[model samples]
Target chain A: MNMSLKNTLKMAIKSILSNKMRTFLTMLGIIIGVFSVIVMVSMGQGATASVTQSIEGMGSNLLNITLTDRTIRFSNDNLSELSMLEGVHMLSPNINWVAPVKYGLNNEAGTSVVGVNENYMVINGYTMMTGRLINPLDIENRNKVVLLGSEVSESLFGQFNPIGESISLSGIKYTVVGVLEENENTLFGDNNNMVLVPYTTGMRQFRTNSIASITIQGTDAASIDKTQSKIETYLMTLYGTDTYRIFNQEQLLSTLNEITGVLTLLLGGIAGISLLVGGIGIMNIMLVTVSERTREIGVRKAIGARRSNILFQFLIESSVISGIGGIIGIMLGILVNRIISTAFEIPISASMQVILIAFLFSLFIGVFFGMYPANKASKLKPVDALRYE
Target chain B: MILLDKVTKTYIMGEIELTVLKGISIDVREGDFFSIIGPSGSGKSTLMNILGCLDVPTSGEYYLDGQEISTYSENDLAKIRNEKIGFIFQKFNLLPKLDAFENVELPLIYRGIKSKRRKEETEIALDSVGLYDRMHHKPNELSGGQQQRVAIARALVGNPSVLLADEPTGNLDTKSGNEVLDILESLNRKGRTIIVITHDFEVADRSKTEITLRDGIIVNRKVK
Candidate 1:
């Protein structure tokens, strides 16, 4: 019911509607700009979300201790004493190497041979699908008992229980004790392509004297930092500086999120440049329109339209163009996100924050670009304008 | 009511100084059907521009209803034009994009009148111009005469104190020209002040008082 505003808006809409194809063409730039911005940002955030979820799935309380030097060795008694530290829930000293696995005529190349103990299954969150995991007695007796990952079990003993079946780790015979269920949340690599055996058995087979890598699970997420520091201080006393490194899961997660956040910002910035170009397009068209309608502006002025009235008329016109373009861009962005998500099997939802920012920035572009031309139109001498042929 | 005292307008087109209106004086009282006739280069168009509040004279005073507004700001002049002056141009000056109804509604809209009142005023103006039935037609859809009538409706919509017509009937055929003259006469009879600037003596002869201008100066006057 604001009389002048309503009147101005009606006039602007009429002028814009008069040139359907030209207006649409002008809007195309903004549409593509907003579309790209939304899609790129959503992809970055989607990647971040999946990676963060997988890492958190393994539990934030886990710590990985690596002995960089081959000379440094940790015995079974030394690892057990570290597990008794405050806020430490569990610990597994692991020795791992890659070799071919064979059972009968079936051979799976590049099988990950992981040496672990009774605490390994619980700490790494592996659940047995059949049979039992390697027990404490297996380590003392140095028995060649192993647990088969789901994929290894499938290849080495298809459709049949791999329990009690003997498999060879590079020509050494090992009895299969259990087959692990399929797990999809492994951060480093596919846990389903690995073999689990007692550390003592692996040491003898691989001929290594030291256990270099160790995984520890804290009692709770809040205690992970404290327990890691305690273990670091304890390790410093044993091996001193530069000989060992402890990787914290929470730190890794944060570092990954930071990287994705920067990438998203970078993509959004590139898309914003396109939007700025689209704004220039609006200005170009608006300038052309002002000149073309010079006589009309004079007539309006003669009929008593104020300079401000004429100014707002063209400004509203450009804003309307960009506003509508932004809406279409958003709808298209969501649609494209859907198509891509389906094609690549990645879950992508265009972030609402990004959508809202793009919409508002587009409107701002309209007004900013429209100012010069509208001012030119408003300042025209009525007599000269009316005389324009 | 309108009065001009010794008004002059100068144009400096890149050091070629030209004085279009050289100390021209004009007067017209309320409800008067006044005409100023001159050929091209006679400065009548410049005089009309000044009277219409579209431009100001370089030197001298312009008084509308006894208020000296020759030195008014651009914004003030716009207000005077909007509320006290109505314009009808030879080209019809109807915004081609707007239909007859919207054309008539423009002045009231500029005046910031409410929609309901503006609609009522526009309807009345279009009815008086005898274009009520064709109010929905655009400028292109209407005949030359009908387009001129819509221009007249637009001029009359704001109920301005003076109607300034710069060759209102110049684009029309003889019959349509006379039709416009007749409407002007009738409206003048109804006590509305009107001023017509034209190069045609016949058009001047229809007015109650007429003047002839040659070389930016009024040379003669006739009481018709």
Candidate 2:
């Protein structure tokens, strides 16, 4: 607030403004540094958020169990016993096949036909839009009953009622018992373009008794890990080897979060190199400034400027340059983030902590790199400085 | 008042020891208009630097206003330069970036003076140098003599104990040089102590006392 400091600051601004091109060139490094950091971290955050949303959509407290060994197979009796294990709330065996489906004169190829048990609708959080879902009797009697997903019904029957209609798959005609509601949380395009059939009927039709995968739900969130270990142990006993992989949603999510977190940090580190380079650029320009203004330093010294005064003037000048660069870089970074979000249609989360850190780090870079040149300016003797040509 | 007792200055350039000033002694009292005349490398500049507190004596004592400043630190010397000595250089030394008014206010800014007082003093100094109307012109925009006048105003704005001018009119034509000399004469008439260092006899003739130097020693001293 003192006049000396104020005047020094004014001098600094005037000098920096006088050399506009050089100042801007010096700031380019920091601008690029901050921009890349924000964009990369934001993209990482977007990826994490999308993966989390998709995982949560599958249902919380859900576990997927897959058998890697083709030789080992699960019988109905074995699956029922596995369902009775501790912490197990529900379990559904699934088998997937691609087939051409026809209803009326309309036909669709590569229509995903999923074979699931009666509990599949409940365990996978599928909602019934019309008619009724597959009941236990449908699974027990190996009935040729089917549920149509919203997209499948739309493709085959258009606006007409799909329930009580017959859809033929692989020359087998099955009555559509119900249609599933559209799942908005589906990540891989549309999950609605599918048909669900009773596991028994699908096994008979597809001539494959081997189940592809099983989805299980724990009693609650806290019991998922315990349920996962129990299922692993039960499978190990049945197959005499650990060939099955049990993926719990919570564990998988945390691992995903860890990977993305490291990725974000790595991105920030790479961007930090440019910031360091930017600091060096400032130092280089400041040294040139000090030398170029050598006579000015001498004149100031002769006019009674203390060593500290000269030091502070140059220090303030460099800090102002980097501070302004930091602000501009932040704005550019946010702009880049906006561009990416709009272009990709992915919502990016911007954390305030990251922005604050980037700004402060830039300022620190100014002070840190500005020290040498300012010190050199301050240490010049009045007589020698005045004599400097 | 300024006094030197057997002051000597030696500079070590690599292995060569060059003594620019060797056992020189002189005295100038308050209200005295003095000039130091010498040829190139005669240590006149060395004496000026010591008198202005820009450099210290190597093996002798220096007194400024009864204070022994020979042993003063760089910081203390800076304060003495700020508070006690005003320097007017041959090149004018006005910062190119600052206009006349800001350049004149620079010494007072270093003194931590309030803006109101600084403005008042700067105006008086510029008016004294007859550059009040041209206070907003930068150094490059002004003629050489006008720039020197601005430098003189900067030197006097802080009201230092003495004005030490090194070739104040060295770069100007005869008319502009005489104009600067007239200003120094009038300022001396107002009881401001002035010291002019030059090789020009015409410039030295205006001072009441003159010291002639040759080979780092004062060979002649004259009083009007």
Q: What would the per-residue lDDT of candidate 2 be over residues A271-351, giving only the tens digit for each residue?
A: 888889999999999999999999999988887888988998999899889888998888988888888888889998567
Report the lDDT tens digits of candidate 1 across residue range A266-361.
Answer: 988998899899999999999999999999999988988888888999999999999888899889999999999999999987877888998999
True contacts kept of each: 0.75, 0.76
Model 2 over residues B193-222: C-alpha lDDT tens digits? 999999999999999999999999999999
- DockQ, per model, reads 0.49, 0.46
Model 2 CA deviation exceeding 4 Å by range: A1-4, A59-124, A133-176, A182-248, A348-351
Worst 10 residues of 1 chain A by lDDT: A1-10
Q: Give per-residue lDDT, candidate 1, residue A14.
A: 90
Write out the backbone clash pairs for model 2: none
Identify the leading candidate in terms of TM-score. 1
Predicted model 2 interface RMSD: 2.6
Off by over 4 Å in 1: A1-3, A36-57, A65-119, A134-145, A150-176, A182-187, A190-193, A197-214, A218-246, A257-281, B221-224
- Estimate, for each residue in B13-34, the C-alpha lDDT of model 1 and write its tens digit: 9979899888977789998999
